[model samples]
Target: MTFQYIAQRFERSGSGSDSFKALFKSAFDLMKEDTANASLYFLIAVAAKSYVRTYEDQAVTEEVAERAKTILCGYNTRVLEALAAEPAARYAIGSGIAYDYEWQVADF
Candidate 1:
């Protein structure tokens, strides 16, 4: 999926960028290995790393960063598998209603 799609879904869920960067990195790793958009993912990875470097609250060690990346990559792989297995429902359900009751509550 494109970064925009992933970003939209992530934002819609009201998640923070700190958490998102990790998942995005994991997704990029997967994409680079299995998809044709490796270059795009690489660019995204660079941007993500830059964002972290600019905004990180405290100093992060290389070891910790690499370990976090590895863990999140595993998580991303499992999520992708589950998504592929159970695709999202495509239909939209809507409801419409017309009020027929009196406005008696206005007498309060």
Candidate 2:
């Protein structure tokens, strides 16, 4: 699934519900299981960070948000820097290419 599609699924699954952690966990697990999709999964986790921020008034706690941010920081600095350099690249899900069209991760 594309990042957009997966993000939409996260929204449809209920943003502030208890399922957020589960969904985020699932995405993280997918990252661990599929190395080729690491970038995509990382983006999903980044989206989760944004999600947590967007819905901070809901069930998502500060601890969970902090954990998400911490995990994102665990990624290779060079890779993150490379991705940061090409914010407008096209990322195809399952293609093993780390690119996302106009996806701004600056806040990340």
Candidate 3:
């Protein structure tokens, strides 16, 4: 499925960036709710590609990748759900990656 492919490519299993954490913060701020780290879903999406820069001309600096939070939410809502539903996916909900996730999006 599209979700599986996208997840594999973007999960960055062994790789964690300060940018990823920034995306988490931004998405949380944009969504304005903390029930779940759903924000991380959007964060991963925007961080995947430089082409998504600023995502609306908002600003795409590594320091402010949160701006793309607005753009990623619409597309990655389901991806978040899939990861969250996984027992091993606690990190997707803001727990931090405890294991590698397969992100096979190379076809993109």
Worst 10 residues of 3 by lDDT: 99-108
User: Candidate 3 on 1-108: residue-level lDDT in tens?
Assistant: 234444444343322334344444444454444434444544453444433332434434543443333233333544456455865454444333212122422211
> How many residue pairs in model 2 have overlapping backbones?
1
Against the true structure, candidate 3 has what lDDT?
Answer: 0.40
lDDT per prediction? Answer: 0.41, 0.46, 0.40
User: Who wins the lDDT comparison?
Assistant: 2
Say which candidate scores most in TM-score.
2
Q: Please give the lDDT score at residue 85 for candidate 3.
A: 80
TM per candidate: 0.37, 0.41, 0.26
Question: What tens-digit string does per-residue lDDT give for candidate 1 at 57-77?
Answer: 766565555544443343333
Total clashing pairs in model 1: 0
> How high is the lDDT of residue 101 in model 1?
9
Tens digits of per-residue lDDT, candidate 2, 55-102, equal 656565656555544433333223334434544432422122223212
Question: What is residue 1's positional error in candidate 1, in angstroms?
Answer: 7.4
96: Cα error in model 3, Å:
12
What ranges in model 1 sit over 4 Å off? 1-5, 13-17, 58-108
Cα lDDT, model 1, residue 13:
40
Superposition error at 27 for model 3 (Å): 4.0
